[model samples]
Target: MPKILPLFAKALTDSWRSTLGWAVGLTAACMLYLPLYPSIGGSAQMQDLINALPPEMTKALNYDQIASGPGYTQATMFGLLGFLLMSMASIGWGAAAVAGDEESGLLELTLAHSVTRAQVVLERALAMVVRIAFLSVLVFLVVLGLNGPSQLGIDVGHLTGAVLLFAALALFSGTAALFAGALTGRKMYAVAAGAAVAVLGYVFNAVGRQSPDVEWLLNLSPYHWAYGNSPVANGADWGAVAGLFGISAAFIVLGSLALRQRDVGV
Candidate 1:
């Protein structure tokens, strides 16, 4: 313990305000959507509205389960809206971790201290892990609080599974951004890479839902891997969670290598 990871504390301190903003946003999302379940998920008209939509549209959006409590919560917080929001936040943090600092010349200052390049990347990645884990816990608690009032019908076990899957999914994008940032030393590349994964993975999952012919896309889509077995209801496929964490670990390793190979670009 040689007082390593000076960057870890610095990163969290630097971004506390942004992290708080994310917290507010996440909690607000939980309150807004979960409360509406009693009105929307419980309504016959809501079902009518869903039925009125094209089957293809419904399938793509996972609207088939909007009437149920667990399904409603999944479609809202853990699946669609919150999913995109968390992914966006993850990408922002991940991009800023290395590429943003490099561009700002702050990385040079950090490097002037006694630290290896891998340590810089590792500390930043650890910061990301902490933040995402916090948000995931935030989601778990907020959703749990709403479960009784909003009638979400989420059990502790299944809810835990949902949040775990959601965390892994968001981290998947974040690590992609980290890898891209380290590889190119450009924040734009990091954002693009992360966005590509979120958007394309979502599309692949949607398409795979359309028919069995393309269902193989489900296997490759991170979105599907998280939600494919209906984690909210089925209590998560542990194998998928392990796969996501494994892949994220690989990205971190690759990012360290990439950063080490290149000039700091400061």
Candidate 2:
């Protein structure tokens, strides 16, 4: 068997286990709220809820009326943004896949074989891609299943867009793990940094929504572009999707280069 496959397989296994709860939580939350969507938080109901919500609560939730339609409401207002809370799951996965092995000195052992440093890094990144792809598939299915009745409801494009967006985020966080592995040589730090980036991005996105003047700051946060469901609610933003993939690619490439340049077990 190929060496990378084992690494990739292990990563996929671990990532699946790690994100299982998040997927469940996402599905459960959407399922639970979906029943209440009509009177509890659809277009007309959401309008009243928004009016009643305090400014701070509204700001935290990114409450926007455009995200109030049946299909879009659950995805945009609830499902799509769940990654903000679940990102730590990816972060933990990234950290364990990379720095955890390194910390155990398995990285040096693996490199002692036929694998080169670049191969190690590439395989690790590939593992992340596979892992995140699994998460994306789960999320898409769960969201689609929960909103199954939205025939003219849930926008397929919007749903696919949101999945791609989160995949990009997972890639971005996974890349940061490489940097954390190289710099700190510690899994904990790598995990924490990835989690922080994901969480902070959501916080910034919230801030941007609440205050238009500082909205420019939203550009810096991944959450700003993660709202593919937003475009579905109103009009999807092709630019946001492009920007997300573009930025995520940059981070992954830069992190790979950095990993290659560094000496392992340093």
Candidate 3:
């Protein structure tokens, strides 16, 4: 086993509540995608709900790309609901992974071993990946079981893409945690910073959706790219996905470099 696995295991074990909480929350939110099932397509009540939603709200929900309803229910889920789940899961996991350790003074002892700081960060990142994957699979299974064959296939595909998208998001959030761990050495501050990034990203996406003139600003926020280019609506913009990964990798490198220079327990 990797030397870092123990650290990651301990981290996850120590903060099982956050992991479990996000799992439950994301699963519940994903159920909101059930409306995309083909069985519901013909329902008058569901159609009315789609129609009644405001134009700006629908756009924020990415209703234009739905394969059924006025648009796909899964698409609406991706635009807003999916992001909310991801932000909570990824940010919370990131916090527990790094800053949480540092704040507790465990990082100093953990780093005293032969293990490198890079290994610590990399392993924590891996733990986040595993946790998010489990939640994603649970959500996909529930979505598949709830929807019919035709709509089920589409919903599953969209949800799969969203899982990958949020995995990338978790990586990005981990970088922020790494930065915070190396910067203030405070877990709470790290979590707050990550949450700030999420909120700002959400606000930017909301404003950009309301006005085309502000749309260019959307490019600045990672959520905008993921939310706007959802596979359900925009059919998976590989370019944007690549860009997100690239930015995430850059941040990861930045945090690693910062860790190398800083003294632990600062």
- The lDDT per prediction is 0.89, 0.63, 0.66
lDDT of 2 by residue, 1-88 (tens): 5654665566567556556776777666556555555554555766776787787666556554434554445344333455654465
Ranking by TM-score: 1, 2, 3
Report the number of the highest-TM-score candidate.
1
Please give, for residues 218-266, the per-residue lDDT of candidate 3 as tens digits.
8767777765665553355666668777876666566666667778886
TM-score per candidate, chains pooled:
0.97, 0.82, 0.81
On lDDT, the leading prediction is 1
Instruction: Report the C-alpha displacement of residue 89, candidate 1, in angstroms.
Output: 0.7
Clashes of each: 0, 1, 2
* Cα RMSD to the true fold for all candidates: 1.3, 3.2, 3.3
Looking at candidate 3, what is the lDDT of residue 63? 57
TM-score of 3: 0.81
Candidate 2, 32: how far from true, in Å?
Answer: 2.7
Evaluate residue 55 in candidate 3 and report its C-alpha lDDT on the 0 to 100 scale. 77
Worst 10 residues of 2 by lDDT: 70-79
